[model samples]
Target: MFPKTSLHTLFPTVNFTEITAIDMSVNSDFFREDPLHENLDLAREKITKFQNKYPMSLLANGYLEERAFYNTPNFERTLHGVKEYRNIHLGTDFWLPESTAVHVPFDGTIVIAHDNNYHKDYGPLLVLKHETETAPFYTLYGHLSKESLVISPKGKNVKQGELLAYLGSEEENGHWVSHLHFQFITDLLNETENYNGVAFPSEIEKWKKLCPNPSVLFEEEF
Candidate 1:
């Protein structure tokens, strides 16, 4: 049996969905250098402006396709190693105001909650272990406020729709827009508090099975 979704199906009161809540570009250019290349302040101001222009509090940029931005000089600086890097995003980003209360979608165990303080990365990360109808899956919450991880420890159990964490500010959350990188995964690759949120184009097939599409698809209806 497949795992039943808790983020959208289980909780009716919370009003969370991957649907066109904000039409936050279900297919966003995750590594679009055009946006980040020019004056960052103006770019952020526009993004902040567009954030509230929609009804949904989050933008679900679900499993995206590969685009060529890695070889560029500007993007290359973000690389750490000489090996090939994964650029395609694998998670749904919740673009909302800072300090938003992030609720757990299912009853799960807090496997690991640690602050991944890296520039242009997920600041404070938290991963939960959940047992569904068929198997035990994992959920990752990234770009969280530092305080959220400070109080959250390993081996803690959380219920569905519970106040799990808070959104981090740009300065704190890897210097990006304030949002929650919420993702569901089947295999954890032996990782505890961390997992790859992006994937290589060649590995998309394997990842597709692990990162299933949300029932409520975020599309442009308008």
Candidate 2:
């Protein structure tokens, strides 16, 4: 099992003061219903076209929606056959664009940084490990620029707020609007470079128990 740790103890002075404030009400409507549900056929075609054109990430400011936790549909049916059924978003995502510079939240070691061309989910991604006096944890920075994967070394150390990598566009990242999929994980499950931070509706309970609300760590006005 991976070591347990409190996020607070890891960065005593870190706070969400640096982020821009966001109005959840305004953005909430954007995802009220899965865009894919409106018209699956048209949506898929649009997604394909968007994937081929912009092919880059987007840049914007947004906040983490706590309500999204319990709002996910279904609970048990989605994870039925999977060996690991923890489905639910375990991290807080900041809706933004591609090519955005992703800075290190704090001092940590780069555990895994790679790309997934076939998955079309995470796209270019990076994982950093931070060990606090009380516990150790990892952070996932997903949907990043393909160039971000080119780094110094696998186990290189990064300074606080340092440039880790730039966000990728939709084409390079999994087919979605440009945004940074950030999440905190307690256990990596032997995943050297990447781990699934999002879960199916059925796996929500399991993920909720394993992954806490990241907003607790980054509670800025936005």
Residue ranges of candidate 2 with Cα displaced over 4 Å: 1-34, 37-87, 219-222
Question: Highest lDDT among the candidates is held by which one?
Answer: 1
User: Compared with the true structure, what per-residue lDDT tens digits does model 2 show for residues 9-87?
Assistant: 3323223223432322223543345532233345345434543443332212322233342332322243345533223
Per residue, candidate 1 scores C-alpha lDDT tens digits across 131-217 of 866778777888989988865677888887677888888878877667777776788878865777767666778887777553322
Cα lDDT, all candidates: 0.63, 0.57
**lDDT over C-alpha atoms for residue 59 of model 2:** 17
List RMSD in Å for every model shown. 5.1, 8.5
Candidate number achieving the greatest TM-score relative to the actual structure: 1
